[model samples]
Target: MTIPAATASFHGIWPALLTPLKPDLGIDLHRFGLHARALVHAKGCGGVVPFGTTGEGPSFSVDERRDAVDALVGEGVPASQILVSTSCAALPDTLALTRHALAIGAHGCLMMPPFFLKGVSDQGVIDCYRQVIDGAADDRLRLYLYHIPQVSGVGLSRKVVETLKRLYPQTIVGIKDSSGDTAHTLALADAFNETLMVTAGHEPDLPELARRGSTGAVSGLANFMPHVVQRLAGRPDAPNTPHDVSRVRLLLAMLGPYALTPALKGIMAALSGEPGWLRVRAPLVALTTDQMHTLQHALKPIALDVDVD
Candidate 1:
């Protein structure tokens, strides 16, 4: 299939969307679409990233992810505005998800190494990616490597990323570094600034990274605070002020104690006054009543600043 000219380069803030679930714990396709549209049009996000770490990508089945993508696009969010993460423990499953995203016209695919089996050899990592790129073998496939060692336990070494870029220069485009280390984010930009599009997960460092040639971010904080991320990304030379930085940090601090996905969902629920937002899939639990009250208290200033309903 002739792919449309690459839909906008992978630059600017792309929120790692927080999946909204129903009471039955099924994906809430309606709320999902609403969130995508609001983030892009209202909050000024360049686009939306579904099925990333923040979106709890691995927890949902391939069918659910596919449906969510279709729902977002059907709701009038352009396919170019969606960056789908297709990281699964199984290769066939990953290929299926990647192919589906490409067929549907997503901006690109953010992929991780087969992370379930940790301690994989370097060559093993390369070959794993090779199989997916070669297997899908589609011209439209724009793959962005995902390197969040803290969660995935599989870090894409510089050598691995460089080799892949050398091998699949067109198909393998960039990476989302969620390593949470400024030095590592800076080094990746320094090394591959010209070739690879590096997006930092650390929101505070986005402006500096952008100045250093990194493209943008796939940020968790942007789920609620896209304007902050957008403002920082839109003006790379002028970083966010200390007050802006503190506000972002405050939200991070408040949510840091709880399991992140649920805490975020609770905050969303409280802000929107939609109880369904608190529903998470198995292996994840919602915040307790006490915790919900606490999150509300801490996030009050941020909620006012963001002007959420």
Candidate 2:
């Protein structure tokens, strides 16, 4: 299947970056920019996604998010290589962030449906997205619909995706399936991989999705194991597929026992040797000392190389 010209540039491994915070829980822009640049330059990621689920998007206010994006761009990570997560509980906030991303020349914006409410009708979901597109009113906008039903309490349905694509083909360029269900991820690839860039958030599904012509991921695992994910998504024929898959599964298993954001931060702390990575914003606490110790022990056996400085 041929990828649409509009979505062609959105392929490859784009790590959903782990935002580092100061001890006061404010965003550490210096650390954040350095990490994003490292992922793209040193780790060979296609790009970096800021304020994603792994980065604790909803935890920060609109101002905080905007400042961080500006700082990242100011620090010399090309704006065109950054995909900003503009999802917010409110339509206005989402619009503001989306516009800001476009203003900065970001590669695209990744947005989820209005997740504050549950069991919303498909039309309602469609309308919410419609308003965002119409509200932003930017021809430069390239949007990737986010689908993570487990965390957001809402999921983007096929009908919703179809309707949005029909209404805004140029703007609605792709879908990020973080569903974690292999069947659903594959089905999405089967249905829309030709027209839209269908990306799996789950690392294990990357090889199969790549087989189906889906060429990229907005991956949490890519934060730490980018080369592994790059190989999985872009080099399925590489001899290391089995070993990479096993390593990803093992790392994900370590995250299973704790709050994912904090646990990933814990791993980042161990890798970078910066305890500042362990700090999380309010409503998400840092991993306990015991949890961190256990994570260290589990990761010691894996012996992942520290690629990011």
TM-score for each candidate, following the candidate numbering: 0.94, 0.98
Give one digit per residue, the lDDT tens place, for model 2 in 232-297: 899887788888888888878877889999998898888878888899987888998898889999
lDDT to native, each model? 0.82, 0.89
Which candidate leads in TM-score?
2
- How big is the positional error of residue 304 in model 2, measured in Å on the Cα after superposition? 2.3
**Runs off by more than 4 Å, candidate 1:** 1-8, 237-240, 301-304, 307-309
Candidate 2: Cα lDDT at 72: 87
* Residue 114 CA displacement from its true place in model 2, Å: 1.2
Q: Model 1 TM-score?
A: 0.94
